[model samples]
Target: MKIVVAKTAGFCMGVRRAVDMVLDASNLSQEPIYTYGPLIHNPQVLEMLEEKKIFRIDTIPEKGSGIVLIRAHGVPPEDEKALKDAGFTVINATCPRVVRVQVIIRKYAQKGYSTLIIGDQKHPEVVGLLGYAKGNGHTITSMAQLLALPRFKAAVVVAQTTQDTAFYDEIKVWCKTHAPHYKIFDTICGSTEKRQSEIRRLARENDAVIVVGGKQSGNTKRLAQIASMAGKLVTHIEDASQIDYKTLSSARSVAITAGASTPNWIINDACSKIETNLQKLHPIKAALFLLRDFLLKTNIMAAAGAGFLTYACSVLQQTAQSFHHALIAMLYVLSMQIINNLFTIKSDKYNHPQRALFYKKNRTYLWVLAVISGGAGLYLSFITGMLSFVILLVMSLLGLSYNLKLVPIISKKGQIARIKDIPGSKTILITLAWGTVTCLLPAVANHSDLMPVAVIFLFAAGLVFARTAFFDILAIQGDRITGKETLPILLGEKKSFDIIKYALIFNIGIIFLTVFTDLLVKRAFFLAFIPFIMLLLISFFEKDNLISGAHKEFIIESSFLATGLIAAVI
Candidate 1:
């Protein structure tokens, strides 16, 4: 079955702002952080926040300390003032869109104009908006209510931001005919309008539509309402486990959309669940999918790629014909990759859902395996020489500390932090580490000439740099949403791509240059084509959405495997 996901199916600008603020606060603040309410309607996010020790307070205490954030749904001006007056450092995380509506209402209310709000009468946003109306606030849900209210000499009409556009249009029509002089502002959020319209299109084109979000979420529920109105089979689910395969089994195609407050992880989980369930009916296909996931999830494919690159690099450096160095490289890479994945599961939750789940479920086993592999690699390095042992030992310690807090209280206020917090550090550090293990360590082991080894190191590091940065580009969306300042996020996607492209070209040139100058054997030249092929594949994937998710990752990783194959033949 084919599955389509809406581009706008995750967190809207406002919710994302609030979530990012909270996450940033989590890392920076010494005081306990609290939100005025659940940060957003999505339960998963709220739960995650709770796990991070960011609590929520439904009612204001007479006195409070630490920091408190207003949720995405704006609160009354007085409530905000009270929170600050109570001595808590207040960060207003209210949606800018909602803040605009409040400013309008407050401006008009001060002029003695009655304010009419169009939305659910009880929603937090509407209630907060009502606060700005001073005593002249009124809310109406429908045209009947609008028609029943007495006409005002002068008033302004606005919406709850997430209000239904069509319903608001009808309200506007009633106001135009009944009271033409009243001011009107279409305060419904543009994102809400786009989401509603997109769901309508999705419903029309697919056999079934799945609306993924909190049932309590107004915007999420409206999406379901719109899909139902379009006469499509609709399922409203909060997460993946709630998906009913029996209902979706007959459908040949499905469209998945999530509410504005929904996070990407939930959307991915729901899609993965559906795909998994659908594949289960055919044992052969199910087995294949399982194997593919296993290879990628366990880091086996990545390890194989590392081994292959080590072989190619060894050949380029004219190293001895022992596989010990190659084996050490593979084990070192495998250990680091697993440990890194375990540390980065939060971002992986968005970039690679299945791999995130794999790490989540097998964390203990994976941790043990990483320790064992790392130990074995270090043992082999010891066998090589004292220098090799010390280098690998120091590298392993640095690897272990990569995610640990290295700089304490660099800021005026102390906070838990690490080298990972440094922008663009991940790509550079991984490239250096991989180059050391795959290129530098091997040369040290073989006692090779410094000049050729240096050239080979550049070639290896350049390719690894290009590959890592490209993956960073592909994951920019999730990285940006999660507030990770990766290389692509810091430099922007287009510039990052240009850098990767040029770096690949440079790597190709160097490979050929080494061969032509008789610095390396003729067979080493073929390895240059490996990166050339990768450059073409990346360009193809970028030009057209030719591949995505696991498939794209598998094929890119296979490029390194292909390097090993070409080297073996030559």
Candidate 2:
């Protein structure tokens, strides 16, 4: 079965902003952090926040302390003032779109205008908006409620940010005819319009549609309502576990979408589950998917890529007998990556669920594998030379201690025990380590000249740095939840991507320069495409709608294998 995910399926701008602000407050401060209400409509997010000790309070306390954030659904003017008066530092994390609607209401309410809102009467956003209406507000959910009201001498009409587009259009047309003097503003969020329209089109095209989001989410439910209006099979589920495969077994194609408040992890989990179940009918696609996911989860694909990269770098330096060094790189990478994964299960619970479960189930065997591969790497380096042996030994020990508590010091916030506790250490260390194993070790084995060795090391490190930073971007959501200060998290996603792009472009330029100057073999010119292709892939992610899951991860790891193929062919 063919599966398609809608581009606008996760975290519209406002919810993302609110969530980020709250999370940042939680991670960077030692004070108690609270939201005035649940951060968003998504239950999973609220649960995760709770786990992180970011609590929510419904009422303003008589004497509050620490910090409190306004939810994405903006609060009343009075509520905002009260929270501040209660001695709590308030951060308004309200969606700017919702704030726009509030501004429109407040502007007209001062002129004795009645505010007519086309949305659910009890919705939090509508309630917040009404707070700005100065007591002359009326919520009209249907044509009857809208027509029953007296045509006011002066009134302003607005729809809830998540109001149904078709319904709101009807409201506008009716109000324009009946109350010609009334001002009508397009208050429905642009995101809501796109999502509704897209779901309608997707529902019409696909055999079945699965809407993944909180059932109580207004926009999410409206999406289901729209899809169901198309007369197709539609399931509105909170997560993957709620899906009923027996109900959807006959469908040949499925369309997946999520609400604006929904996070990528939940949507991805749903997509993964559905794809896994549906792919069983196609043996070839199913087999390939299983194989790819296995390699990704086990870190085997990463290890193989390391081996291939080592071989390519060796050939670039004109080193003799590159296979053994490639093996050493592979073993070192396999052992290090496995150990890293084992220690990162907390973040993996939100980043890569399947891999977390796999690690837990095979903990003992994986430990055995890591120890053996690391030992084998040491043995190979020892056989090569004393310098190689010492370097590999030091690198391996550092890798092993990365997740271990060496400082044994506890602070007011928590223990800054492990090397991983140091912010932005992972990306830099991984790049340096990969470069050492792939290029520097081989140069040492053959006593290659410094200029070529240094240039080749830069080439290898540049690609590995891009790879690490790119994955960090993909896993930013989980990393934030787990309080990880990755390069992407510290620099922000856009800046990190900018850095990755510049790095890749630089690598490409270096490759061409070396090839043109005859400093490296002509086959090394093919290596330029590695970074080039990666740049294009990163561009796809920058589109801001692609799902970061197994498929993207598999393709990225395969880029390393491309290096091996290029080396072997020449």
Candidate 3:
């Protein structure tokens, strides 16, 4: 059995330094030693340290006489002060890269550059950087939100040491646009870039790739994402023992990569297991595996299309008046065909063959479903009333325009493409559509007063904008890669983040005004608004990732649906 290891395997500089510092302090310390947190990301390493009588403490103990080591992820200044005040002997194992972030932040603050740290606010490194800035720096996670900030002069941009390099570049460009004089310090560690690039290269070449690291380690998770983008079979694992041998039984070649904190032994153990499993598979079985993979991919596409159409039906039913209104519904269905075609054309040449195939295979059935439904909808609307028919026609056009030739006209002209590419467009469009369909479509079809309709549209627009901006923050990378100019890409991460902040503030203001204007039933509507506020709070802390993005959409959609249901009942 042969084992191949990635060139960048094992503990990185920060992890190495932190581990060594802890061991050295343990050797010399007389009192029982403790780490402020896990000294490194790897649980194996922490377990070993615990065996040696080293332990973790969240805060300085009451007696506080033991040697207290700070983790590679530096602690906030106030916490460090509290530890020192408690009479603990402190050993600072803070990574050099993280230290640089602290220095840069302090420098910017001293120079009066209204400093901004573009990173996760809850992250230890980010928390430390903020403390070092001493209340002068604002933390931003995306560029679109940053642009909406009250204009600041002499802004200096820095990132969390583990942040994506491309995101850092996007933030720099955004600051250049909004700030009078902007300075960017590329503070991301070189090891992170090297590891990410290496994983991408491996994923492109390998049949399958395993990214081994702690789930909580940001850098390791990024390596997994790079592998996913290359369209390789990637599994992220915390240790060698967690590897599912059954999944790799037929794999001929598998590449292994680890995060900054992963130990060399773990990588080696996983590789050995992979080779042992492959040896047990026969040639015929391997061929069977490939066939199984193909069938699974095909089934997945069919299932997805069916699911989407079902959801669209539910949405239409909620908005439309009667079963006879199915003709207008048919148009809505037809519009989906146009969207599917546009996506197929745009994505066919991408490296992910599975995605292209999925779109192509399901497109025919999707189109048929759309056309039949749309045609039926139009005929029913005409039979019912001219006004209802017109509304259906307009909606069908809007849906088609979003993805087909009509929307491409905006893309080709550059102005509209640029605007849509801006971070907030998708969120803005989806939310607005939901709100409009829920509030206005029913009234217009029934010839109700326009005043209530106008109020609903306005209120819905505000909430939708808030929700969409947050999702845009999550999709910054996809938008950048696909050349879909979004707020995060155009304005940079920090600026884009500030824009979301301002948007939320404005949204809250509008909600208050609507309350005073009696647009909402004071108590019932306000109670419903509580969930949205909670969603906003959750979005603030969300890490920019696919799971978080999905979660954000789920929360926003639920809020929209709940608000609509509550309003309808009232």
* Leading candidate by lDDT: 2
* lDDT (0 to 1) per candidate: 0.83, 0.88, 0.61
**Cα lDDT of model 2 by residue, 1-570, tens digit:** 888889889889898889889998987788999999888888878888998999999998899999999988898899999999999999999899999999999999999999999888889899899999999999999999988999899999999999999999998888778788999999999999999999999999999999988878989999999999999999999988888888898999999999998888788777877888778778888787778778888889999999999999998898987999999999999999999899888777776777888999999999999999999999999999999999998888778767886545354458467767778888998999999999999999999989888888998899899988988887787787778889998999999999999999999999889876767877788889989998998888778554536667777788889988888887
Best by TM-score: 2
lDDT per residue as tens, model 3, 441-481: 45566665565456545554555555556555544433333
Q: After superposition, how far is residue 187 of candidate 2 from its true place, in Å?
A: 1.6
Clashes of each: 0, 0, 35
**Candidate RMSDs in order:** 4.4, 1.9, 21.8
Ranking by lDDT: 2, 1, 3
TM-score of 3: 0.48
Off by over 4 Å in 1: 172-180, 315-326, 340-368, 379-389, 403-426, 445-456, 462-556, 562-570
**Candidate numbers, best TM-score first, in rank order:** 2, 1, 3
How far residue 285's Cα lies from its native spot in candidate 1, in Å, is 3.7
